[model samples]
Target: MYKYDQYDQALVDARVDEFRDQVARRLAGEITEDQFKPLRLMNGLYLQLHAYMLRVAIPYGTLSSPQLRMLAHISRKYDRDYAHFTTRQNIQYNWIKLEQAPDLMADLASVEMHAIQTSGNCIRNISSDQFAGAAADEVADPRPYAELLRQWSSFHPEFSFLPRKFKIAVTASDTDRAAIQLHDIGLQLVRKDGQLGFRVLVGGGMGRTPMIGHWVREFIPVSQYLTYCEAILRVYNRYGRRDNIYKARIKILVHELGAEEFTRQVEAEFAAMSDLGLDAPQAEVDRIAAQFADPEYDAGAPDTLDRSDPDFAVWVDQNVHAHKHAGYAIATISLKPPRGIPGDASSAQMDLIADLAERYSFGELRVTHSQNLVLAHVRKADLYALWQALAEADLATPNLDLVTDIIACPGLDYCTLANARSIPVAQKIAARFESDLARQRDIGELKIKVSGCINACGHHHAGHIGILGVDRKGEESYQLSLGGSGAEDASLAKILGPGFNKAGVVDAVEKIIERYRSVRSGPDERFLDTYRRLGDAPFKEAVYG
Candidate 1:
């Protein structure tokens, strides 16, 4: 984990003081709602339907035990006993009060965390692969770069007020767990001739107009990484639509100007700035990289888990992942329990997870984009003990990447922008497949994402089975989409036909899964793979008929 230094601590403390003053002014009737809108948004506070919502940034989803404990304390004291972990690798407090928000921010700053850049039209949190350092198939850990970007983009004057919110993600693994293709800018670390570099993709986003990013640079030298990113951001900041909020995303800019022309413009900008010294200094990069050095491990630890208990075996097979190190594994702690809210972790659960991370994972953990938590460096020999502890805390659910492991937003239940309730749909779907573990295993990997509105906060655009909630007159209806993915083979899901009522939506999903099962060439084939092979016709007919 990256520890905050004197400079980092100073910056956060100053921001907390500034926000505290602003909040006081607002509550004293010194500022109107319209006047305070941007001010609050800049600090990651939103006025939701019922109350103020505060989103806290979890940079690249990494957290220390102390930070996690502090979050638990905040939930217990200021919030409603729980916090919602979002798909952007952030956490949200839905029932925040304006007066208490400043205190919350101050508490967060005490633990080296803040809500800056989690909202607003400025660059949002820079995300990375959850299994960054521990993954077996990664070129290198991407967090150091993400941290560097975080430092650089914080309150950058040039990008302070862009057309809309911008998101950037970095991934080093062949498997794209960060959903890089769905971000404003996506960087993939690569090695060519034993020299490290980046493959840059720009303008990929999901909103009203979903788009897969176009590759601007096939390979950019590591030395020019920051410079290249600046060039892309400059172009978007200058030319991206400012009149229409809907068309303000960089993806629209890339769409209007062809990829080739966009690349040409970016190249021209890079060429001019290459000599102006925009590249991050090697010393700075090395300084940040040193903060993320691998943790010490015992060489004598065993590599295998005891599978004598079938329950342990099931949990192991589903929740554990192979690590780069010999005696370690990446353990995913499921937040999606049976009929439970998708990413809501109680205060007690947070404390327990923090304890587990300290005991087994070097006092560090990572939050997944799918709203799960990861003990990224757990020793394989401790699997049984860890499983027992997690089960006792209701955190051991053997449904990683299964249909029951759903991704859902707060929807109409908490969000003012939402037209329908997404949580209930997600709960119903999970309950529908809750029983029959064997049947779920047979179904294999199926990603079901639900969004409350067209904003795509739940990442419904990238799920194998994407559900979007829409308002029809006064009632809520759901639209189903198929064949979407957010992996290395990124693609937008296509809508199936007319919308369905709440119950009909679940039935339609079941029918789609049954249709997939009947047509799959093998049991190991996933829903996305089957859909890719058979197209959407079969699934569409199965749902509509």
Candidate 2:
């Protein structure tokens, strides 16, 4: 819920003007496609399979109702009647016309949102826990720091052209909901004694080479946070591989230079940088933090939060989460229905979400990295009523962190690089496991991620059951992976031998789950825990042999 200041407003407006001119030139044939590619990418515009796709940044996955409504209007008016929420918590319009992109950017600026840094090999959108401010167990809200980094990295001249894309995520909660370990730089907000700081993790990434970040700094005081971050980036910028894009990420840099050596280099850079005293200005930090102050609450007598409605109770049990503020909760609007596309929200649905955010929640909505929409900071008392409204809009599917609530990327259907379709595969899986609540609760803690290619856009490597789609001899095939997780205990999934044809992938998943069920010590053991205990041998044997 951070509002844009004059500086932020000026920056976006300038970018819009810049892109407007670039787009006009491209349309006028003043620039060739080759000459225009980087310019378009820097502005977050993509030439996709059928049309241009414009990705808009929802910084740290947070949005205001006005912002959400603006997006809905954009989708309905300019392009298709729906938008796809990406795994990074950004939203994409797939059918945008090349000429209209600049207009769209201007429209986004009207609502204080823009597509800058949503694409390109620069620091992408700075994501934090979608539940940051609201999560009950958080030590501090991570958004302030995330926003601070966002402003710092926005157009940092030196980092604009890094060897590869850089991603940074911060989380304040005990549970790693932001998938911090899977990011190039993960900062865990921590408090020790009376001082607040960050526990920094470096080198984590997921693409062809997936890695869980290594802890580099145990505690970096808030005052020194940005200084240290600069050192890390400086080190990567100087030495990170550029000859090969695949080896260009900071993760690969950290791997090639041992963590100890990498840490030493960063420390040396930090020591030198500190002498110049270029840490983020405290005034800037305080200024951003002020924008995110906790909303004033009544502190009055408890209001009645009725759950008498059976449907409402079901939703509360499944979709609601504890909030840091008293008498408030975070409500996740599930995108996974019995047969619905996992993260596709139609224009009408987007409008409904925007309205709900304005009315029930605090005029703030958050898109989760898990591809679900969240109306954070809803008053507990209005939970039932909100559920009723969401249910009517087909947004009240109560399957959070469950098997049916799968994560998928736009595959062969929309993405030019994809080998197979991801949405349909996700749909088929959801239908196959169509939520017998008891059965799913019994199965427990399964994270299935499916991606169209080895690019790992859907983060298949982080799934408890990862499926990677590939084209084999002119046919679509899927490769299954086991034991992956994206939580505090993050691990790269292990592949289960030969890839299976489209029809065989589902059966293969069933076989893996059955093997887990058979080997599990008790019903209490989740698939991940059991998989860890027994290793991939059992699941591999079941699927491959």
Candidate 3:
């Protein structure tokens, strides 16, 4: 993990002091709710239906053990005893007091963390693959570049207030685990003729208008990445819609202008900025890269797991992922235990995770976009011990990409914008399929995402089975979609048919799954693959008929 320097510390300290003053003014009635909206948003504070909510950024989803412990401390002292990890790889505290927010911010700053850019219409947290440095198939670790962008875009005067919020993601592997195609700006690291470069994509987003990004440049040399990115942002800031909040995202601008003209404008801007010295220096890149050097490993550790215990074998199959090093594996800690709320980690659980990370993963952990945590560099020889510890803490659920590992938003339970509750739906579905391990394994690689609204915070648009909650005639109804994916084969899901009531939605999902089982070519064929092969007609008939 990258440590904060004097400059980084100073910047965060200043922001905390500024927000403390702002909070005091708002509480003292010196500023009205209307006047304090933007000020509070800039500090990552939101006035939800019940109480104030605070979102804290976990940059690129990486955290040190001390940082994790601090999060536990905040959860215990300030809000409720649990925190919600989000699809964006950030964490949210739902029950917050306005007067105590400054104290929370101060504690976060003490651990080199903050809530800046988490809620504002600015460049949000820069995200990357959870297994960035340790994955076996990666061409390069994308975190150094993500950190570079984080520093570059933080409070940049030019992009401080865009028409809408912007998100950027980076990935280096052929498999797009970061969901790059659904971001405002997606950067894929590539190698051409043994020289490293980037494949840039722009305008992709989900909200109301779902889109897979348009390819802007096939290749931009590593040296000129910053310049090219600046060009793209400059164009969007100048021409993106300002009249309607619904049409303000860069995706709308790209849709109206078409990819060809957008590419041309971006090229023109790049040409003009190329000679202005915006390119990042090689020395700076090397300096950042050095900060992420690999940890020391045992030279002669075994590569295989001990399958003596069937339970440990099940966990190993589900949670352990292949690593770049022979003796290492990436261990995913599931937040979804049987019927537990997805991504809700209690304060004690957070402390236990921190201790496990320190013991097994060099005091570091990464948060996954699927709302799980990763000990990205765990040694294979220590798998049994780690699994035992995680089991005792209720963090060892042997379901990674299965139907039970659901992605769900706070929904009506916490979010005022939501129409229905998502957590209960997720819990019901998980419990409905809890006992059938063999059946779930047979289902194979299914991702079910639930969102309470069209804001798509749960990333329902990218799930194999996407569920969206809507208000239909004063009753809570759920809409179902199929064939969505967030991997390298990124695509938005298609709606099935008429909406289902709360009681009926789960049955509809079961019907769809049964239809998939009946129609799939083999047990190995996933729900998304079967749907893609057969189209929506079969699934739609099963659900609506």
Candidate 4:
């Protein structure tokens, strides 16, 4: 994990002081709601339906034990007893008091964390693969580059306010675990001819209009990525729509201007900025990379697991992944319990996780983009003990990418913009399939993502099976889409057909699963593969008939 330097500490401390005054002004009636809206938003505070919501940034989803403990303390002392892990790999507190927000910000600053740029027009928290350092297949760890981008974009004078909010994701493997293709700017770190660079994709996003990014450049030398990224942002800022919020996204601009023209303009900008020295110097790059170097491993650590307990074995098979280190494995702590909220973790659970991370994985934890937690380098020999602790707390669900592990946003239950409730729907769907582990495993890697509305905070457009809530004639209705993925082979999901009521949608999902089972080539064939093979006709027929 990267520790804050003197400069980082000063920046965060100054921001906390600044926001403290802003909050005091709002509470004292010196500023009206309209006047305080942008000010509070800049500090990652939102006035929700019932109360204020605060989203704290976990840059590149990395957290130290003290940081995790701080989050647990925040939940216990300030907001509710639990917090929700979001699809952005950040954590949110639903119930917050405006009076106590400054105190909370001060607590976060103690741990080198803050809510800055978490919810605004500026680039949000930079995200990357949760399994970045541990994943066996990645060419290199992507966190160093992600951190560089975070430092570059934070409170940037030129990009403080864009036409709309922008997001960026970085990954270093063929598998796109970070969903980079669905971001405003996606960087895939690749090794070309023994030299490191990035395969850059630009103008990708999801909302009312979902799109996979266009490949802006085949490969950008690692040294020039900062310059190239500046060029892209400049192009978007220059021509992106300002009149309509709906049409303000860079994706919309890219669509209207066409990829070729966007590329031409970006190229011109990049060429112009070449001599300005926008890219970070080699010394700074090494300083960042050194912090991410691999942890010391026991050379003689055993590499085998005992399968004496079938239940423990099942959990291992489902939740544990191969690590880059031979003696260790990456373990995903599933937040989606049977019929429980998808990403809610209580203060007690957070504290226990922090302790476990320290004891098992060198005091480090990684938050998954899918709303789970990862102990990146757990020793294989200690797997059973970790499993036992997690199982006791109802944390070991053994459904990593299965149907029960659904990714859903807090819909009408919390979000004021929602037309329908998402939590109940997600619960019902998970409960419907959660009882049958065999069925869930049989269904294979089915990502069911739900959003309360089209804002796509839940990333519904990227799921293998997607559900979107809408208000139909003053009633809550659900629309279903299929065949979407936020992977290396990224594609936007297409709507299957007409919408359904809450009950009807759950039933419709079951029917679609049954139909997929009947049509798929074998048990090994994933729902996504089956959908791509047979298209929407069979699934639609299954639901309507």
| Cα-based lDDT for every prediction | 0.93, 0.88, 0.92, 0.94
Which stretches of candidate 2 lie above 4 Å from their native place?
301-305
Against the hidden true structure, what lDDT does model 2 obtain?
0.88
lDDT of 4 by residue, 296-358 (tens): 977777999998999999999999999998889999999999868989999999999999999
lDDT (C-alpha) at residue 176 in model 3 = 92
lDDT of 1 by residue, 276-362 (tens): 887679898898899999999868889877899999999999999999999999999999988689999999999999999999999
What is the TM-score (0 to 1) of candidate 2?
A: 0.97
Give the backbone clash total of model 2. 0
Residues 1-545 of candidate 2 have per-residue lDDT tens digits of 68888989999999999999998898899999999999999989888899998889998999998888999999998887999998898999999998788888999999999999888889999998998888889999889999989988999999999999899999997799999999999999999997999999999989889999999999999889988999999999999999998899999999989899999999999988887776668787888899888876546625446777776776787788887777888899998878888788998998988988888877888999989999888888778778888888878887888788899999988898899889888888777787576666567778899999989998999999999999998999999988888889899999879998877898888888878889999988989999889888988789878
> Ten consecutive residues with minimal summed lDDT in candidate 3?
278-287
lDDT (10s digit) by residue, model 3, range 221-265? 888898899999999999999999999999999999999999999
Model 4 stretches astray by more than 4 angstroms: none
User: Model 3 segments beyond 4 Å from truth?
Assistant: none
TM-scores, each model vs. reference: 0.99, 0.97, 0.99, 0.99
Ranking by lDDT: 4, 1, 3, 2
